[model samples]
Target: MAGVFGLAEGEVKTGLRRAARLVLDTLYPPHCLACDAAVLEPGTLCGACWVGAAFQTGLSCDKCAAPLPGDPAEAPVLCDDCLRVARPWSHGRAALLYGGTGRQLVLALKYGDRHDIACPAGRWLARQAAPLCRADTLVLPVPLHRARLFHRRYNQSALLALALARELDRPALPDLLLRTRRTGIQDGLSRAARFENQQGAIAPRPRRARRIEGRHVLLVDDVMTSGATLAAAAEACFAAGADDVDVIVLARVLREE
Candidate 1:
């Protein structure tokens, strides 16, 4: 239905959208994602922020996405932490190492109510998570306890999971896992204490059990510290009759070297 100046309706709509964006950008101006520095694009980091981000590129651990110094051609690598610990999930990937600009972005999205960060972080996650996905895989987030959800108003991990699912064109069940117990914050806890705290804390809902049965699952979360939280979530998936599970997170926290 061409109406104006021999242009198609779709073209007209696109032109209008571009015009609106141009006006808005001119007024507001784009800023760096991690910092407030001006950037040419909306969802980009500045030159300094880019250098400080520590995005994972090559030679990463297969079980968890920690950086390793080795040949890029190597296959099926494991980091020291993953090797020492028993991981219930089959595989894992992360978009960034949790420090510098990456850590700031995570904290912003998690506690500062900066939901806009999810859009860019999700794209970064999707790139790392793609190779781990399967046709039958069901993507879902590590659930937050009801109390925590009420206080925070939104679950940042669920937002990232939904964004990743959209990018991959896969099915996502956001409420598949339930945090039955309200465990306190895991920050500053030792490795063993963290695992003990998360133990048996999450489980699948009985009514929703059918949705998880026999499905291959991909668990998503914002960050992986001790990995105790993910392990607990994966264990819940298995309890719900999942065939197997893998994990992906926006960032992976590394122990001091």
Candidate 2:
């Protein structure tokens, strides 16, 4: 009888806890971080918001992942900006444009500490890279400065890399590269200024580069604005003996019209 009473008490406690959680979830229901509409579950945006934020398909530039303005069947070509300034990496791609709901989602994941959002974002990135995921490739996230890591207590790029690694069954090396210097924010800077700001900013830690040598690497970042940061990272990876480096991001900022 004592054992029976204990089991009953355990069931009662479990029920109470579940009821409490339901009440809490209802009162402060998790909403879409992008559109602010109530979501069916946490870490997810509503369908409208998802549609609004997803990258447009059909025709995109092969090199930089920019949507071809009109014709869906056109061959891939660089946009005017890419034509003027040569990109440093082999190629680049992103999951969305940098405005509307997409930018807010990125901020929510980074600043709001919505790490769970990374699964969906990373799945989207994998789908984008589906045609290109090579068996021999290595996944690496862009590094944050030690100072920023201490302040934020987490790296969004690392979260994204973990997600991609799980979905693709690939190895995600979070510490393969290091950002040794913290520079000014790259926004509002000219192309040359952006380049100068990132020069010599990244280095491959000798201890971490053992597995990276002669590997095909895929560098991940949340956004690509000027391609300067990634360029710096790829340069470091190559210097550390990576045979080739390609890049993927959650978004790419096109030149404003």
Candidate 3:
């Protein structure tokens, strides 16, 4: 009798939740992730917003995913910037170039408290990151310092990572990495300074260190500027005994743009 009652009760609760969600959606239809214009789906851009985004579909650098000027059929090669710097990760990709609609979406997700943006952004990232995945891959986000995380009430990168994990049907260990120290804001910092500031900021959590060994670590982030933060995070994965490392970002700052 107890088992039968428990099963019926569970069904009732599930039905109630579904009904509540349906009512809520009807009362407040989903809006565009970028502009708040009504969209057919919850995590989509409206037509105007879609048209303005600069998706990186052309041939790009395998090291950084920065767009190159060769044929689309051409294989990806290293960008001049990637060649000039030591990127700790083996490969990287970004869904959008950081400008226009792309910048708006990134800023919204990062600072505007618009977490719904993570849905579409994560879908885009999952698509871009498919090529980087390996059979032994584990997904992790570049972490936040505890103080900053407390103030923000959330880590935007972690949100994106969770969403990507769902889309890709992969496990996301959001707490795998810890920001060892607070590297203050990167605004106006020279490229070298940004790299220096992020030099030792990230590492695998002590308890989670064992899971990283012999794994291909794929680091997720909201944006890549000088590739400094990603570089630091990749280094941490290596130190944690990761077999290989790759990176993906929602947007990347293309030099020409």
Candidate 4:
């Protein structure tokens, strides 16, 4: 069953690229993403950075994914904030705690075009989102209005969604969710202002509405500050006949009180 140039089962197949790989490994092997220290292998971060990484832990609020201050084993561990004001989406999950290294990494991926960083971060998001009951998931990133899209040249939410979908082995539905109206910048807005500004700011594409029906949609965004934008998008998805809607974000900024 062997071909004319058949080689043995354990034979060394030589090539110029293999030789180049050897040279490359010796000169510049893989390094940690957080720090420049050499790592034992590719796709791994240094021990110190990995240990220091602020991973999301403990039971989170059922609605907002904010960590609750109680034993995780207890059911109904909703945070006080969630009890006060219900979120639009069923629930949400985030891979890392906001601020510190997590915040810096997100900024780098967003503005620096360091897309390679997505691999590690996206993998973490996929793991965090696995507990949801619905497996037939469709990922939808919060869209930037056309005007902002043109100015930014790309949407950070869309990039995060794409990376997340790939990690979760789900289809990312970017075009299905559309932001037809341009809203004011949310950075400096108060919580009330953020909600008011984002009102009527997002709508599902008419033609694409049929495709989302009866599906579990996961909305992805880079950050959740006031949670207004996510709420608006979830409302639109529900209006379009989506069976359920959940959200996943890179970070959730705790309100300054």
Best by lDDT: 1
Considering TM-score, which of the candidate structures 3 and 4 is the better prediction for this target?
3
157 in model 4: Cα distance from truth in Å? 1.7
lDDT of 1 by residue, 1-257 (tens): 99579999999999999999899899999999888899998888999999999888888888877889988589688988878888999999999999999899999999999888888888999898898888888999999999999999999999999889988889988888899999998988888889999999999987987888898899999999888999999999998899989999998888732
Each candidate structure's TM-score, on Cα atoms with residue i matched to residue i, is 0.94, 0.83, 0.89, 0.85
For residues 1-257, could you state the per-residue lDDT of candidate 4 as single tens digits? Answer: 43335854334344555777778778889877766889886555788777766777777777777776777687446678778887888888877767776776678777777666777777788887877636678989999888877877788888788888898788888778888777877888778888899987888999888878999999988877778999999999999888999998887676632
CA displacement after TM-score superposition, residue 137 of candidate 2 (Å): 1.1
RMSD of each: 1.7, 5.3, 3.5, 3.6
What TM-score would you give candidate 4 relative to the actual structure?
0.85
| Candidate 1 residue runs with Cα over 4 Å from true position | 1-3
Give the clashing pairs for model 3. Answer: none
Best by TM-score: 1
Off by over 4 Å in 3: 1-22
| lDDT to native, each model | 0.90, 0.81, 0.88, 0.79
The global Cα lDDT (0 to 1) of model 1 is 0.90
- Write one digit per residue (lDDT tens) for candidate 2, span 115-196: 8789888888888776667777889999999999999999999999889888888899898889888986787888789989
Higher-ranked by lDDT: 2 or 3: 3
- Residue 217, candidate 3: how far off, in angstroms? 0.6
In model 1, pairs of residues that clash are none
